[model samples]
Target chain A: MRRLLPALIALALLTGLSLLVGATNLFDSPLDRSMVLAVSRLPRTMAAILAGAGLALAGVVIQQTMRNRLVEPGLTGTPEAAMIGLLGVTLLAPGAALLTKMSVAALSALLGTAGFFALSTRVPRRDPMLLPLVGLIYGGILGAAALFIAWSTDLVQFVGIWQTGDFSGVLRGRYELLWLIAALAGLLWLFTDRLTILGLGEDRARALGLNVRQTVLAGLTIVAIAVAVVVVTVGAMPFVGLVVPNIVSRLWGDNLRDNLGLVAVMGGGFVLASDVIGRLVRWPYEIPAATIFAIGGAAIFLWLLNHPKAHAHG
Target chain B: MIDIDHLTLERDGRVILDDISLRLPRGGITAIIGPNGAGKSTLLHCLAGLLAPRSGRVRVLGRDIHHIPARERARLLALLTQSPGTVPRLSVRDLVAFGRWPHHRGRPGPTDHALVAQALERFALTPLAARDVETLSGGQKQRAFVAMAYAQSTPWMLLDEPLSALDPKYIRDIMDRLRDLAPPRHGLTEAPAASRSVLLVLHDLQIAWRYADWFVCLKDGKLLAHGPRDTTVTADLLSALYDTPLRLERVSDSSVILPA
Candidate 1:
């Protein structure tokens, strides 16, 4: 809990700053101060926090389940699969309810993740870096397919919104689906021990009386739902999942049951800070949070690739 | 006692363990020795109920090993595979505590805590309990893993090459610990507390000769010899098992195997 103090403080300060630094200044504007906070500012901050936490949780789950720290929900074709589902729903029933669209996205994301897992087995195990490379290419193919479909159907603008993570359009009613991430995090808490066992690999997990198949399916399902919900509500944030869990795991170790809360807080803090920076960089004009995360995330990813010794087991 | 009757396992149209049968009496360290590709680890997996044989069965303490549920089997016997993959970034204490998982099934009780603490103390890992397992040296990590299996508190342990890459110091350290903790007790239906029968696959002949009380030799997936080490193991059998000329020699206080 003491380790969480710094993250909690940073998150609280970011939340305060997020509410204050909008186009309509709370102190000077004619708009009703309370209405803006309730409708836009509060929901935006909560959406960022929820999405960041959920992605980080998803990243850790997939990493443990796959026994590879280099992969994340973004690289595993999860968000791309969700995009395909959203495109299909939008084409079939443009006026479908948000819940229905989210359900479809979640289902497709699960299938996509499952497909990647199937592909992962065929990749040779001698090189740990190979799996993530395969995941990246797999995600790229799915993403290209989604882009092609969007172009043909004239849903390109909608795809852009889901591809780029921005908080400018968030309001109370628009972003509630991200709250599903909170519930997913709670569900993960229940299976923390099981997930830790999974990192030990199939034979050891089986020897320890863990039903490896069941635990892995449960973990991947949670990842799919979290990634899909975040994408449908606030668009895809690429490296929040990839970078945050790696950082936390390096700092506090991989005791999932003990560090779940810390991972969530740190994830929320990182993304919120990114969003705040994106907002401040151009003042009235805004940059997407995903853009800022990518710039930082790619650098960290490169460092991780170079420093494989830090992750080597024996 | 473990009763193996006509046990056979085939993988990808290749017979790994051909028709083989043996009764392994409980107590003492039983070493399964064989050359490369002799199906030693495969047989260990079958005994642990992690793999099912194509024909015949293995019975542990009169119950069909494969027929038992996973959790119940875990309680009955613990298995440690060769060079366990993916070093989880867990602390030494937490890794050892995982041994009590079968008993608690996620919610550990006082007994589990006591056993984990006892296991750490017995393995002399109290000083490193808070250290991440990944940071430990090879010997220390092997000891930590051994402690984990020890903490499982099962009546039987099946280990695949536990001393494969360890130095003589660690090998002797672990063998001595196991010997003192689970000395062979003859003709007893019930095992006393802290006593376990260990079955392991070994590649180091000298270490096996020094530590193992019984020998089970395999070659080309067929059992060649098995019984008390003094009676069943000979220089000729050792040579046949590895297809290399070897002689059993008395080296002062203990016997050692050397190429003839």
Candidate 2:
């Protein structure tokens, strides 16, 4: 509880900042301010927070499930698989309901993540870096295929927005799907110990009376839903999951049940702060949160690689 | 006691354990000794109910091990695999406390907490209970894992090379702790009243000979010999088992196996 205080305070500050700093001036009239706050600012801030928390939770789940520290939903072909599903829906039904598209994307992302899990088993454990590299390559292949389809179908513009995470377009009705992450986070909380047992690998988990296959599928299902929902709502946030979980694990240990709340809070803070910064970087004009996070997250990733604390692979 | 009836296992169309049949008496430490690829670890896995053989059955304490549900089976047997993969950055107490998982599922009760504390105390890990498992030395890490298996409070412990990389001090520390936990055996027929029966795969023949009350030797996936240490283990059998000359010699009232 003591550890959570500072984080909660910082997140509260970020949430307020996210609501205040935006393209529109909220001070013109009380009615306009309230209208803008309710319709645009509130929804965008909530979207960033929800999407961040969901991605971080997904990141930790996949990392523990695969027993690799450097992996997350973005690298595991999840977003690309989700993009393909979205494209397929766009091509087939052209006007399919958003819910239908989301379900399809989530299912496709599950299959894609399952493919990475299969490939992960064949990867030798001699190097911890190898699995993430493999995930990168696997995601690259899926992404390349998605890009080709998008180009051929003349849906390149649609694909571009989904590929980069931005919150400028978020409104009350559009980003409601991201609330699925909150439900998924609650679901993840129930499976906390099982997910931690997963880090022990197959033999140990089974020895502990855990159904390893079922638990893994459950975990990956959560990851797929969370990732797909975020992609569909605000586009892909690359390193929110990757960086938040790693930082939380470094400060606190890997006891998923105990540290989950902190991870979610910190994750929300990380992305919301990035979004707030994106709004203010060039006063009136805006930058995508994904671009800011990519620059910051890449630097942190490099630092984590060189740090001795990151030697959990051994 | 473990009963193996015509057990055979094949991997990738190649037989790993071919028609192996043996009964390992319960109540004491039984070391499965063999050369590399002799399927010692594989047989241990079968005994722990983690692996199912192709042909036959394994019965532990009168129940078909393979048929038992995983949760019930966990209450009966605990297994510590060799190099249990990546150690999560969990505290030592938390890792050991996972032994009570089968009982509490996820919500650990007071009994679970008490047992975990007892396990920590018994393993001399109370001082390091709050430390992260990944920060421990190789031997300390091994002890923490053993403490976890111990905390499971099962009737049987099937360990695969629990002492693989430990130095002599840690090996002796672990062996001594295990010796204290196993029921005292007077003869092969004496059944243990309540204590755990340990079955381990050992690469160190000296440690095995020092601590194990029974021996199960395998060569090329076949049982070479199995009985009390004094009756079943012979210099000639040890030599044939490893395809190298070995001698059993006594020095200062203790028996030792050395390459000859």
How good is model 1 by TM-score? 0.96
Per-residue C-alpha lDDT of model 2 across residues A74-102, encoded as one tens digit per residue: 88999999999999998999899999999
lDDT, model 1, position A136: 94
True contacts kept of each: 0.75, 0.76
lDDT of 2 by residue, B96-140 (tens): 999999999999999999999999999999998988898999999
TM-score per candidate for chain A alone: 0.95, 0.95
How accurately is candidate 2 docked according to DockQ? 0.61
lDDT of 1 by residue, B1-260 (tens): 89999999999999999998998887888899999999999999999999999999999989999889999988888888899656989899999999889889989999999999999999999998988898898888988988998899988888899887889898899888888766864543434665789889999988888888888999889999888888889999998898899999998989988899
Q: Candidate 2 chain A — worst ten consecutive residues by lDDT sum? A: A305-314
Error of 1 at A301 (Å): 5.6
lDDT of 1 by residue, A199-248 (tens): 88788889999988899899999999999998898898888888988887
**DockQ, cand. 1:** 0.57
Identify the runs in model 2 with alpha carbons over 4 angstroms from their true place: A28-31, A305-314
